[model samples]
Target: MDTPDTPHVNKERIDTMEHLSAAIGVSRPTLSRYFQDPDNVSRTSRERIRKGLERVEYVPNFFATRMNRKSTGMIGVIIPYLNDLFFSRLLEAIERAAMDVGYTVITQCSHSDPAIEARAAETLMSMNVEGALVAPLGNHSDLDVHERLRSRLPFVMVDSRPDTMPEVDFVGTNHYHSTGLATEYLARVGGPPVFLAMPRVNFNAMERERAYIAKMEQLGLEPRIVGVEGVSGAGYFEAHGQAVLEREFSSGRLVASSILCVNDRVAIGALRAAATHGLEAGAMQRGGLRIAGHDDYPLCPYTVPSLTTVAQNVDAIGRTAVARLVESIRAEKSSGKQILKLFDGEMKIRESA
Candidate 1:
């Protein structure tokens, strides 16, 4: 029996990894691979090594290993906010894609603040990540942070990008064409829709708004933009939608028979508002307001009337972003050329509209 205060016991317990590897009946290199990433080792070897570690109470110093390695085999993913389902799903997809390539992922949230976004970028750079996929805060992001990152390693913008970074690579949904499809559908089936404008936060929202306006004008319907004042970020879309609709109902300003929301969350909020005003919302046959939204969120199917929306190709966006970054990493020299890839959205017509 070894006592806590015994120097002999301490020395015996603090065995080197080489000794542990022999004890576990595994080669030193196999044990090293397990320490770097358990998935790197075969299942049988991993289980044997894990049992050996438990028996000996031995652990590898990962921090020291990271410091010694020239490449960390890690990827950084940054998004504006995590509360939104759209972003959460996007992050999950990106992580899966990174893991498929034997790379680990670390994530940071900016909470839609420019200063916080800059800090996140700096932290990722400091960690010496092999590459990064970012969904910038558009006009609000710090240009200096992006420039510094681009000069150091491969970087790809997902979902959105800053207007200043013209040379950066981007992977995003085709907001213009997607919005046009939704707007045109609403006009063909029901009445021309009144557009619900999101807070001018990201380029995605701006492009959606522009598409809605153009589509309306093309259809020969006067475009009406309804916006909520003094609201931004996270739950802002839903809250703003509710507030605006409530005011419009009371003042009888909601003239259109159909409404097109910027995204599914806003459409959900609009549904709640419509219910409060004792107005059922769905197809025209249901004697309710016809409503449609973009970016079919995960919960859209379960909504009251089953929301009609444009489904963004989040999986494609995630896979493409990771592949592009990996390609850049393998390149001997940075091309300094820009690549913009946009996948079209599919319109899902359900009970709503």
Candidate 2:
């Protein structure tokens, strides 16, 4: 049943309905109607369409055939850093899930910059992305950009939280509870000495800080919360971060065996600082100081004597974010208020505490 004008003979390219209508002498519209929800059409016509479909290869242009007139078969996924394993793993999962459903995924990195994040969102919107899955830089993100996109494109926040963008769905860890676990682990193993935090501007980090303070108070320990001063991006291997860690290391009052970090990178920097002062970061029984981190990075296990940390389900976060965004796009409505989808983060006890 080869049509002279058929573009390709692949199983997916066949115009089964058209070919069957031509062969069985049925109108194209009636044949089309029969193909879409066969129960709605006459039993005889449905049977004929089914037989025709089986005889010839064909796949509907789901982008065109979907009941929703607006879905574009494309989704935009944005993450804070593409190089970070947590974000990268999440993106890979999202990309895989999107491809499985025949949806194209366009990924971008905000580089933890607000302007860049805004530009990236605008770019995706201009391309007419059906939906977006963003792991924003939290406070660094431009709320206006998100607001505009929320008005038109379906979007979800993954792995990060803004102040309160009610228009978008949020999928991430419950930092407050997760950080409490981190604190409790520290109290049980090393005792809480200092909790390293970044700017209070980040909603998630703020939650973690509050959890740390609350846990410290509960355990009747003096909470020494240290904020890494300077720019927001400085938390990531910036010179200011080194200086901050240096000061922490130099402060002789920090008697706590383990220091809780905002994230893996911050812990890494602090660990390096401790090492510079000839302090070993490992189990006390093994004759070394203890350090603990959050968001177990890929290199955590490789850090000298290994780094103990909290591990979030990065892959699950990405998969769920994409699935949720796709559903919102298909639903053609964002009225479903921002859902705080929190996945439990587990503590990986290792050499460091």
Candidate 3:
């Protein structure tokens, strides 16, 4: 039984000292330098310290260690919903990139609630996190909280842009181009298609919707914008989309040869609805109807007929957000003006046209 005061620095732990020295082939003082600040030490010494730590099973008091450092070396990563593959992958890439830069990531999923997201950010801020990379809850973000954070810390927005608020920096996809790409791909292969989405209050979704309309008009096709409530990819909400589709299909009001979904997950749900209504959806070669999606999720390739979608440069967005946030923090400046950085999306043409 070891007490908090006494770390397991017993014979079992110390016996490895000789082996560690032999392995490292360095004096303990030299090894200590690596632990004190690996970046300051020679690469060889750092490697030796890493090997020694493994052999001796040492666990430094991280609390005391951070207390001694100039900065906490921590970053907060906030995602709207972790269940979505895109958000999850985005967070993972950000975490890995942050860790590589010697910063620890504390992640939180806000579950699509504005209050929850605000609380999450506030909580992380309370912990003295150096900065935050956040996927804000669209219009649900607490501007008051963000305004206060502006005075104390730096935060970068991802995925969704704040509306009419000029107080944040965003690293996200080129939603307009991506949606246009999806629509064009659909139009070229299966003729123009109706664009379906939830409300366009979300910044990304608004951009996507704009692209859809512009592209449809450019191609001389009438735009059919289908509106729904709630987010994409839920079973029940998708069922509602299916009902709408069925009504439109039956009424001959479906204006296009196919449909461009806001995302692969949404497309999957729409495809289910299409199938349930006995409409064939797949490759253009044999398509009775074509379906396209955006944000080529991990499951995009596995979906029925293997969805054709637009793949956002989420990895780049994550990397850019952290790098920018770190820079902004070091600069000690929050312009309270928004900076929107848009990364492009690649078109993944598949059997779904």
Task: Please give the clash total of every predicted structure, in order.
Answer: 0, 0, 0
Model 3 steric clash pairs: none
List the global CA lDDT of all models: 0.83, 0.74, 0.74
Winner on TM-score (2 vs 3): 3
What is the per-residue lDDT of model 3 for residues 1-353, given as tens digits with 9 covering 90 to 100? 99899887633254343455666577765654455577867887787677656666555556555645678888888888777878888987898788778888988878887788778878888778888887777776776766666667787878886775555787888877888888887878776688877665566777788888898889898998875565344443345456556666777665346888877766777777677666657764453578888888898898777888999887888888888888777775555566679888899988777
- Give all candidate RMSDs, comma-separated: 5.7, 6.6, 6.7
Alpha carbon lDDT of residue 320, candidate 3? 88
Report the error of model 3 at residue 121, Å.
Answer: 0.8
What TM-score would each prediction reach against the true structure? 0.85, 0.76, 0.80
RMSD of 2: 6.6
Best by TM-score: 1
Candidate 2 residue pairs that clash = none
Q: In model 1, where is the ten-residue run with the lowest total lDDT? A: 6-15
